[model samples]
Target: MTRSVYVTGIGRSDGRQVVELGVMELLTRQVDRVGVFRPLVHDEPDELYDLLRSRYRLTQPASSVFGMGYEEAAALQAEQGTDELISRLVDRYHQVSDAYEAVLVLGTDFADTGLPAELALNARLANEFGAAVLPVVAARDQAPEAVVAEVRNAHDAYASLGADLIAMVANRVADPEAAAAVRGLAERLPEPVFVLPEEPALAAPTVAQVKEATAAKILLGDHAGLSRDVRNLVFGGAHLPVFLPALTEGCLVVTPGDRSDLLIGALAAHSAGSPAIAGVLLTLDERPDDQTLALAARLAPGTPVLVVPEGSMPTADALLSLEGKLTAATPRKAEIALGLFETHVDAAQLSAQLSVERSERVTPMMFEHELVERSRAARRHIVLPEGTEERVLRAAEVLLRRNICDLTLLGDPAVIRKRAAELSIGLDLPAGDETPADPLSGPGGATARIVDPQTSPLRERFAEVYAALRAHKGVTYELAHDVVSDVSYFGTLMVNEGLADGMVSGAVHSTAATVRPAFEIIRTRPDASIVSSVFFMCLADRVLVYGDCAVVPDPGAEQLADIAIQSATTAARFGVEPRVAMLSYSTGTSGSGADVDKVRRATELVRERRPDLLTEGPIQYDAAVEPSVAATKLPGSAVAGQATVLVFPDLNTGNNTYKAVQRSAGAIAVGPVLQGLRKPVNDLSRGALVQDIVNTVAITAVQAQDAFPHGSGG
Candidate 1:
């Protein structure tokens, strides 16, 4: 099932739209893009959906969002029965859910529409949309006891209708001690229940909203100040001395424009930044002189000064009824809404409930998240050679924060520490855990450690080991001693010596610089004939594996078959189903070339070795990926389309194709993951971004889990 949540209000004034925006914030944090669906809306534009599209940068069209207006839905239900209405709603809902990694479904609102049983309708729609129901109950203006009953009833009502209840929320609760009284409902509910006190800022209107409501003219305003939230409205009937105390942060001062003295005092306070006001609302069509108005504009360059023809009393009534709506113009409220959610709701619990059984398609985000989760489950120690690199330090902080794995960073300790402090990365050992001395270190168990390769006590031991490994190649003891102090060599020796389970480097060095030590010291597994690399190409919707893109130069038919098998194992291990495609310039027997024969022979070898693997060979790139292209090029081939593992004939074609797709199609190529090694030793691109480094580290840690299942000492 698609991961989706439907947030619906049980009745009017629930103010649950904030919950939807908050959930969108969470979903976008998890995935790159999130789809929003509104089943039934009014004929007018959906202010909330517009806000979602603008703020979240959603690309869902109106055809998916405004499926059917309330009147149209009501007419359909009356004419064709509710079943037909539900069927069409489900169709429109799937249009969005299928396109996005995660979906947020906005349920039907019980506004002025004449539709009956809106709660039941929302429940049915949520079930049909395969969404977990998160019903919001408004507790404002009701007694604590009544609010408790309402929350319990809402949960039971949704659960009774076979709706998957995600969580229960009581929004805008009214009791003075509602925070204390919310315990009753919280304890009774089986799932997590949240209670949010009415926030005045979220319930207040912005300067732009007030201007629209009162039809006020902008005397002094800019685009920015017009978006400020009016936390409170103050009418300037008091003297200047008493009125200043009534002002609060984000307050909008209302006064007769003729009161130049009060207006000047307010602008002076605003200029001093004592209590920053939202904006000023001038009433009664009164005027400050030209000089004073110009002074007001200069005092606060972007602060708004709106003038209306109505009296202060009427303006107060209009402003009091208007509440803040989530829009692109109001980002402060979005922050506040997200804060409320992050503070009150258990994000981990919610995410666990939102998780569904894995489907056939593996998204890039899902693959990355699974890597982090899987690595963290069985922690390992992975060594990073470039400790002083800025991207490595940043990714180290993230990996430690996520508890992904303990890290060993190799460099000069003093330089690494100075740079890390400059970058504000905290790597201090916890209490009772001794920070390492200058040369050697503690085990650095669940965090990170900095090792100075030149000064470390293990350098001589590593020198002896390297001299033994490379003695046949005419390397002497003194030369091996100098070579062992290099960071990449030291880090790889750490992996070989069972000090760390895996290694990741190459951020500030060449790939050969990082991998040469691994090839020399660690060597390949006994069963493997050659060491090759595969890149996990993260397309927008799916993740595909492209093999030998970095390691091999001109592999023969046997080496190409080994690369395909290694790539299929890597893909399947990382949650991608590997339908291997031995890619060539030709499609089956369509063209004849030396490269085509090599790929054809490789495909035969793969079938002979692993008959269980679904594979096709001598296929073009389009035929390997696109179903329509496959239908024309190779009609009956099983792996013609939907191939997750694509093995190229040689390195030049695979590397160039991967780069072209990465640049043109905006795919993330996460490796060059070195395979067939006795222990996992991966390399990074010198130009890798911080996220790329993080992803690569996660991949190395997961591989380390397979190498060192019982912890660091393999």
Candidate 2:
């Protein structure tokens, strides 16, 4: 039987979407194939449905997600009675249930449904679907006793209707006494009751929402700025001194565009980190002069500046009507929501109650999650040379928030902080008056160490070490000293000298600029013969390892074997079983060429060296991946169609093939992760995004864990 949970609410404004999202998160963590079904949806597309599909990476089509439109369901219920409506919905529910291991049934919203017994309808649907019910009751603006009464009533209503009750949730409780009252009720009720307090940020309107509501023109700001929440509204009508006091954190300043004094003052305050504002909304559509606008851009590079035609009063009225929705675009709010849910609710107990079975196959999301979890288990410090890059700083914020790894950002401390401020990122630096034991301690107890290569005390030590390591290569002390000041060399030395566990660079530098330092300093492992690279190509269903993609432009038979062996080791280390496939233009001796012969030789070498590893060689791409093609081309081969690690004959083929598959098939290529290094030093693409940086950092941290089994310091 399919295990299903029905998330139903007693009334409108209950904020049940949070509970639904939280449940989905738990379900995804448990099962790989989780489906969502909305019994009755509006004619317009569902925002929450889109959010779940995007965030959870659901493959189910949108038409299959809901039973029917609310209007259609209402008409059916009216014409043929409620029995027929329930019958149709039950059939639709069964379709979703049969397809998935678990189904999350979203109940009807009580708002404007034109139905007199919406709660009873939800209970009936839950009963018909044979699903466990989790009911949410809104306690907003209610007293403690009223809130308690509402919870009891909601539970009884569902129970009386013969619904299979799993638990109860009291959402949006504002009063402290009400919150306490709900907690007390949890003990009295038969089922567990989770009480969540009102979070203003969840309800706060984003800059994009405000712009949409007022039809405002975006004069400045990027998508990142537009997603910022407007927690407060400050009218900029007073003098600079007086208006400055009203500037609160995440406040949206509303003033005329001609008020350059107020605009510049707010920008300056935001740059100084004195309660950084969300944005500045200019009324009357009056924009500042070009010079003033340029100055504002310099002050806060990504801060949103919106221009509206309405006056302040009308704009405030429009803003008051806006509310935040949990959509795919508002990812930060989703994070905040999940954090709140995890903090307040006992997720472990809830998951246990759901009884969702774990999946055996590893999905792309599961693989990514495992990477983060593994890295977090043994936290390692990773040094990033491109610290001042906007994407790097943003990635640092995500890394610190998730507690995945400690970071050492190599650059000028002041310049990094200034750039971070311009990007509206919080570095969590210590107070100016206080000095900490570790100079790298950031806000919220995360360590984000910043070091200037030129001024760091370790510069001379690094120079001496570099000169000693490269003495055979004719490197002089003066040349080593000059090179030590470079961020890449400095970062590599940190890993070599045991200051950091690993290093990830090359966001803005060339591949050579990033890897040359590691080659000179860290070198290759004792067991490895040649340095190589592999990219973890994350396809829709699974992840495959592609090797020799970035390094080693041309590998002879010996180098090709070394690359295959190294890639197989990397794949196995990262939870991918190694079924090595030596790819070529020919398959099973049907065609002969230099490339095919090289691949065949490499395959022979791998078999001779590691007989325990499953490998096939001189196979075409289609035969290596597709079972049907394998049956025709190379039947009875052990690793023909099931190869997890593909070894390209040379760099050109590997690089071009990985990129073609990535762009054409919508796959995420994680690397260019350099293998065979004595210490882990991975390089990022010059166009890496924030998540890319985060994933690379996580990968580097995991590699560091392998490098140092017993502790960080080698």
Candidate 3:
């Protein structure tokens, strides 16, 4: 509740020294000294305690923070059973709290400190000592969210024990989204959340990455900024045979005749403006062509272009020999491009499918029996707006027929029937045609009267509110009439009142037109700080998640974190634990700024808040999938080495990055998977196909499962 809070008890491992230091530095201002209580201390020298003593400036017994000064007693005591271990741990906390202001409880390397008991002891101690309680979640090679969840669970246990939760610290947040998600969760929590970003490991070669995938020499024009690992092979048109050796070794950019202006221009544009090219190869058949040489010099003043004797087919063949070296591994540029392609083609295919047209593209998550079972248990409900588009009608029918969702169609029964008939479909009417009840008439109409009846204390409250609503300028009788008459809005009301599950619209209206009413009437989820969108990408070989694809503009770290959690959870619903990678211009600590800082801060927050999620970031798209690149940039980061979900920094980055990946990577982008809604509702593009509708419906069904387990619509 306060701007800042104190933290105390924490267990530490050998490598956790930096973690301890970073945490203490961040929290030192919030409270005086943090009681460092741990289950065990192993192989730690007296100097470690000396450092801790100096940092907190403790004058009391060294055991106050070090728990017996790293002696054999500490090691032997740490191996004891949970109950005894916790009993001593709690006893130590009370003794320390007499001097310190707050207790920052630490968990073990894994959740192995008998978490439940430790939390329980902390709670009892907090009550006895009258000190605020903070839980520091530390993990080794675990997902950020998972760790956060464990911390939260422990915190919950402490809270149940009657201890006040001051804040939570997530140690070793490795990704941008993971951090953001933790931060976001923290922002929404009753207490503050802190995440500690992982430090970079070592710089690995971009050239090595390119060379391992493709047998092409790294050719630089006049500019030479590419990584050193990229091999350089001078190009000469006449010496085709010589270029052959270079071709089999690495990535090669063949320029026009060595003295040509075109080659220089291409090199300058590519090397200076984009993904660093490995090297440049220039063709040279004749010695002195003054004009061509001058042009080359002007275009690529600093690039090192390899010169080789020229002959078209032979030169091309020399380059062809390197084909065997080129693997299918995707580069960052290629990955980003492919994501775009997948999104466009997939969205188009889905759009057509929703309209009943045959489509080649299948949604990432097909409506299989297992998924359906989940849906049945979850009981997702979907709403069809009034006067249904031909596609919406068909989609609803298919969903009901397929048992994918509890379908609700808003509009007059007769009108809907009429429309259904026009579309060659049958339907069961909910009401007779001539009822003509004014849904907006408040307590005057039969429907209003039906709602106004003797509930309890809120009956008059509802009546008054309805009357006042009608008086409000925006709540025009016409608009109110439409809301009551429109089945989609009406169905949304059902969801709001616990009668239905989810609502979908936008086929016959704009996104704003459909969402405005929901935002105004239904409200956001209880813990949700903001609303955002995600795109589920199913590539030929893998599934990727991209977010803020349809919502949020300049999201701060907190907002990005929310988007990451929402996206990760959505991905999990589709059967992926969602190793989320927070994307940025630079990988690891290669860059800096508020944007980079925000991502770093968010990653820290998410690690502290969710801890259960695997995430790493400030990573390039390439680093998300390429284990080799990840090894270089993030080293031991679990997510950076192999990420499945990617949270972009902002809308531009998210949208453009997704589009680029889909388009160039040949991936299928399945959704603008909306999150934080009450039910499994989704939007349809104006030009959506029938398959798109079916797929969207399927996704909604899954969401329904997530929202309401056991098919409870309410």
Candidate 4:
């Protein structure tokens, strides 16, 4: 079997080529027959892959390595579907995988935007290829906590999806803080995590890179000067003495072509061994006199002097935007990257893991990947009650890794730390800050804090608030104080207080335990008379929304209609087209019974309330899902077989059907997601796996995004 790794990033301009080169180094060392694959690319050729081919002497043809352009893939997806797009890419991947002992798959980098969609597509491609996911997190000058958080979340996301596990790397970390970041990640992450400090030499853009960016004319230059890493740019708008002082080593000097004085002064300084500058860029498409140019060249032999048509400001913009590339031309950068990777990572352990079965076993992919992508689009914060539970810890790692949303885990700080260390979760144990920084502001990466309800400063305040809210029931502050100490209550209070946008509980707790606090504190949205729950049934080909599965018991016709409306909205919000099926034992008017009548009436109510929705009711399960069954039983009905939202008559029917599909069909059921809440709060099954917790947490974050668009959760 071919051992493969998918190298990708969650954000744009992540500077992941270093990790890609490092992995290529690892793969070539492990096996002589190494192949490279890039699933999607922009219009231009990939510089890094070209470098790999030249350097590694790989025999695999470009046709095998390059799948298709992003535009081509998008066109295919529009014409066909994502399934067809992935199918072709998977076939392309196997061509390389079958021919090589080891393969390295590079992800896409578009000429433009759409990062969230691209990241999700990359993840799906990784899964369809059955490759172990290796995500490179860029931590360029971000806080130490953010760096570790990003790595952990990335690991968590892929790991929860049941992708073959590989270690994570936090690359391009600021050098001064890298050691501290490494030490902090020693205990929290559940997987092997490595930190690569930023290398200035590698980050410095070369004269060639600047020229490419500015489209300048190289008036006079040699290979050495052009290849020199440009560390800083010095605008020569000052006198000779003033500019001489600013002429630091590796600085790119930008001046008017006529500024022979500034040019000669800079090169004279370099000649006097004040460290060689990265050559001078002449602006306004002008050049010095031949005599002065000759003098400048002699002062620093073979110095690059380029001229651009743009003014100082435009040239400055180009220089500032340029970053060094690790192409075949820059073997030094490749060496530096490999050194960093080898220094921080255990290559032997990685090799052993690469030999695992993840490369050959492709699992079904849909809900989990899309769930995460949607939540990240508009970030929100969610609190988890069972902080010390292994499943919750793992789920938190993935959520924070993607910086999916901010998270607060309610539990004892020490226990959470110990448990996280035991599980090897890469958390760095986010400090018990009273409140986390805003995740929506930038990609700083989200984090989770372990707040012990017993000692939380907000506990008493929450108790008093709860007492006042429930005082009509004769609840006292003393009684509320005891209840608020429970993790579930504490987390819900966090949501109610706008401390967290939403809450996800019940990995170790019960559904009643999770939702009871929400029912009491979070309450119902003003538009809703009652709260309901829906399960997103992620079948192999599509997602089906199942409603009233875990909330209302035996709801009347009105409540059933409300569930249908809520479920349809939830389905639409999550990208599923809302074709509602009011489920019962009977189909249409084929049968006459009380249950069927209730469904028919509920469906009618749904149509009345949400006149825009496509709803059909009193439909059997087979007719609602299988097109063949729908055609025979309820012919010409638009929603008979195309239903994306299924509203059961009551909790018994919804809950049992969801579980049966979850167990028997091997579908991923993400929910019991509560709808019509003033704020977002959700529950998990006690038997929920790590992936289930991950899915539910993502759903909660997305819901929170909807609820708290204005503030934290207020």
Model 3, range 1-714, lDDT digits (tens) per residue?
111122344454323333333333333323433455543444434433455455344455656654432244334445774455446655675676665543443333322432344445445545554545556666445665776675667567666778666556565566666677677776666766656554211111233343333343433332122322233333434344343333312234555553344454444543342222344554544332666556555654444444456554566665543311111221221211222222212223222222222212222323222344355444455555533466776555445434455555555454555444323232333333322122212110101101212222223333344335456555655445434544445545555555556666666677666665566556668878877788777664356778888778898998888888888888777766689888887788889988888888878777777899887868888888898988887788888767878898989888887778878985656667678765555666665655456567667767766676665564
lDDT of 3: 0.52
- Each model's lDDT comes to 0.82, 0.86, 0.52, 0.78
Q: Pick the candidate with the highest TM-score.
A: 2
As for candidate 2, its clashing pairs are: 428-443
Q: Which of candidates 1 and 4 is the stronger one according to TM-score? A: 1
Error of 2 at 150 (Å): 6.5
Candidate 3 Cα deviation (angstroms), residue 325: 48
| Residues 399-478 of candidate 2: C-alpha lDDT, one tens digit per residue | 77566788888777767766664444545643332111255654324477787788887888899999999999899889
For the record, the alpha-carbon RMSD of candidate 2 to the native fold, in angstroms, is 3.7
Q: What tens digits encode model 1's per-residue C-alpha lDDT throughout 407-429?
A: 88787766666455333344542
Clashing pairs in 1: none
- CA shift at 646, candidate 3, in angstroms? 1.0
For all candidates, the clash counts are: 0, 1, 116, 11
Give one digit per residue, the lDDT tens place, for model 4 in 248-274: 667889999888888888888776656
Candidate 1: C-alpha RMSD to true structure equals 10.5
How good is model 1 by TM-score?
0.62
Q: Cα deviation in Å at residue 414, candidate 4?
A: 1.3
TM-score of each: 0.62, 0.87, 0.43, 0.54
Cα lDDT for residue 11, model 3? 50
Off-target runs (Cα >4 Å) in candidate 3 are 1-370, 412-415, 426-479, 482-488, 663-666
